[model samples]
Target: MSALPGLDDCVHCGLCLPVCPTYAIDRRESQNPRGRIAALRAIEEGRSAPTPGLLRGLDDCLVCRACESACPSGISMEGLMMEHRSRTSDARSDGRTVAERWFLRAVVSSPGVLDRFLGVARLGRSLLPAALLPDTPGPSRLRPARAASPPAATSRLSTETKGRAVLLRGCIADRVQDRETRLAARLLSHFGFEVSISAPGCCGALQRHSGLVDLARELSLERARDLLSGEPDAIVVDSAGCGSALHEPLSDAPELHAVAERGTDTPSLLATIGLPPPPHPIPGPVVFAPPCHQSHGTRSTEATRSLLEHITEGEVVLLPGEEQCCGAAGTYFLRRPAKSRQLGERAKERWERGGRVKTLATGNPGCLLRWESLLRREPGVEVAHPVTLAARAYGLESEER
Candidate 1:
């Protein structure tokens, strides 16, 4: 075996140490980025073998790829982790991996099933055991359809509604997201574009992240065909993780390259088309938590940050752990609730120390839901996505029928 390509990219500068969520939580060398890289190198060189401890370390990883952002050498921790899991897929220690695989295929692979499953999960959340289900999603966790006081001034976007846009509502996204989905469509249409927002199958992100490479690849193709069928000028994704997955072109399907070529996060598109300053109605002291995939995958949260700051009149506060994962690395929260909660708490504590904020916003479904669960008890805080805020800035929310 090639022993996982790109293990040699680490210079051991230790920058990934502070940004790593698992490393920060467990304080384990074997769980850090460089440590994992070193372990793989040793295994390849025959100096070490896959022991129980080694496997356990890898299992604890969130694979959020914050290390990639912190790395000076541009080492892709996301790619490395996926490849490592694929190589060891057969040797998985427990049947839990099997259940995860089945869930991805049987339930999540289809848009319809995923919706029903999430619905049931939310309703029966209290009934489910802690180990199987993580935090209970508070009613306010998902962005409620509340519009801020109507914008004082009409927001400006391109007045010409000409281009076509296709919004890929990733499997779990449409069900849980409100502002990003309903508001995203309205925002795009308000921007003078013909927006297509509808049901969508998996993007293979969860599958690929879970080490089902072949399945992920297949799903990617299906998503490509569906996304491009509309001949969209822009394929927009409100979910950070789904958008990040399509950032890389699918080499196997040459036609699917357009999926990556045109696929963009909503903020990126809005920023590119020239987002004029919208009314700043959001109360001061708002915090923005950059989604792990949004920041790490794009390698910059500037577009989202810049747009957010402009909307809030530079009142946006960068969360202390803004660059760190929110502990919802896909399905990690569901399976490893304890670890996920602890990591979320670390970020929460750091956030609270800086003083309370009136609103908190993040761009991914997992991160949004996680925040809702974490901050449920804390009153007077609104958690939302930029699209929702954008809608308020543009006065679309008041126009809602």
Candidate 2:
């Protein structure tokens, strides 16, 4: 046997039953942790090699970390899944034209370069004919819900607040919704945090998941040291994927303890600060579509919904199972647009079953972009970050303060 780490962690107590999105979607044992563990065990025993079928079971997983959250034995499904991805078959496209390879490499390595590229992409989007835009380019740069000014600097923090935090302004999130990052900063400061953007670039989660394990570790160690050098208490990350990746331990660099101690998701941090929920309840009826990563991986759904409920008077409507993935699956939407769209459409229909949906709240930018693309044809549907809705309801500025 290959002796996979944590292989014996699964007690098979079925504690993760409710949190498995694939299992929820299909109601099959094969799609849940139990089956996944079996598959891994088989591979370890050389009973079944890492064939396409085995890869599909692993790949189809949203890696939301929900299973681990529900595991009573403290089983680390997320870690296992990441290890599997890191060792899996190379799934990249065969004919990566020079431009494609260069673009991916450049963006993964350098945040400044990616931001510049996004700026050009946005300019092209503005200038090109609507029909000419690729069906699904990378990610969107447009801010959702079209709101007000976001926070500007540390000066916005009151003199009473003395602690400093490093805000890991994500490459993808910054490109799509810089406003969201600003709002996050403002909220952090409002809770007595002095926030600063210290790191120079992307977290490389996307590249790492796309079979660039070495590159991911390199980027992780580099960024870890850069942010750690500032000696901040914590690193506030608005992007779920990036934050999750940041929280992960880097085996390659044992000395980088800063990244391990300080990294936390925006919602979790907000909840940690004991920020009271909004005084006013949301007025309209809405569906809270927790991102797969946030709900499953980070398990921040309660904090997210609790925070939203405090801000608006709207009635929060959760789906039947509540743990099912919305299907965006990060870049999976781009790689498997057809399957992604199918999943998104289904989620939308569920959200709008009896009547109209005033809003759909999600934690990840990718989910927001996916919802926008899926419902672009359907008028009156609005997808926004939970914090954006909270900010609007509380009369907080959308732009930098």
Candidate 3:
């Protein structure tokens, strides 16, 4: 009981209950944060075993941390959930758990394997529509293989140069988000920053979100060390989930914690140093889905809005139920496709109301993919990262680096 976060601090005020998606679905006490914490306490205190019912209750949680925003006691629900999962998750208990574990530990976390895996997915998408497949992550993004380096473009600044920065190319993102990664690099370079791509790697977000803490810790430490090796002034990750995960205290290792502190999202870092007024305006109205990680975890919504407002001509509308999870809670959709779709239906509802909007921008890759999957039938609507939109507005894709 003492080992779990928020166990001792919980006031049981039930502020988190209404925001919990699983609880909303089940309406069971077992599905909410307070109930989950009680289960953790019972298990830790040896008053109850981690039985299938209790474990299932915990497993059903999205870990989206939607509840954290409502907590008055300042409880770290994600921290408690991750720690609980780290100790209790049993891979051998069932085949589903085993497969999910294998995919994250063996496939999604390995850059080479992830690329090949996505290669197979891209092949699959070539045969049929990716929208028919719930698990394939934004198949449209896997463009023909190209050079990873940013084009050598001239900077507008002559004397006021920004310091060097690194862009983390994530595990699955190495393939799926390659263009966004390149666009981000191109934009950062165009913005007067000397940017370098972090070597292909996993930030352990998928793993950590799934409760595989030890491996997440190891992977985070390694990636953090690698990101820091170049001595860059900033490590800008365009992926919200990855940026938020970078700050996760996956391990108690001081070095890992130190390296984690330097990671920031493109908008947050860009907002700090500022940018030249965007020469081109994003066409038409834009609808934005701020990722739960950004809104609830890092609290970078203002910075994200500041950067969005810089490049757009029209209103950047927030999706309805902005507090809700997209159900892409790292590979959660893969495990529970129907429930994931249920969770993501809110975005679709808002998309229907967002008439005349061509671009649906989001900060996180998962949310982008989620929106892509949810709104695929509306081919006219383009789903993109905010940085991708910013990069396009700057015409960086056409300019030579």
Best by lDDT: 3
lDDT of each: 0.76, 0.66, 0.78
- The per-residue C-alpha lDDT of model 3 at residue 367 equals 80
Structural similarity to truth (TM-score) of each candidate: 0.90, 0.80, 0.92
Residues 190-281 of candidate 3 have per-residue lDDT tens digits of 76788888778888888887788888888888888888888888888777788888876666887667666777877877787767777787
Residue runs of model 1 more than 4 Å from their true location after superposition: 126-134, 139-159, 399-401
> By TM-score, is 1 or 2 better?
1
Q: Which candidate achieves the best TM-score against the true structure?
A: 3
Against the hidden true structure, what lDDT does model 2 obtain? Answer: 0.66
- Candidate 1: tens digits of C-alpha lDDT, residues 270-295: 78778776754655667888898888
Model 2 weakest 10-residue run by lDDT:
142-151
- Kindly indicate the candidate among 1 and 3 with the higher TM-score: 3
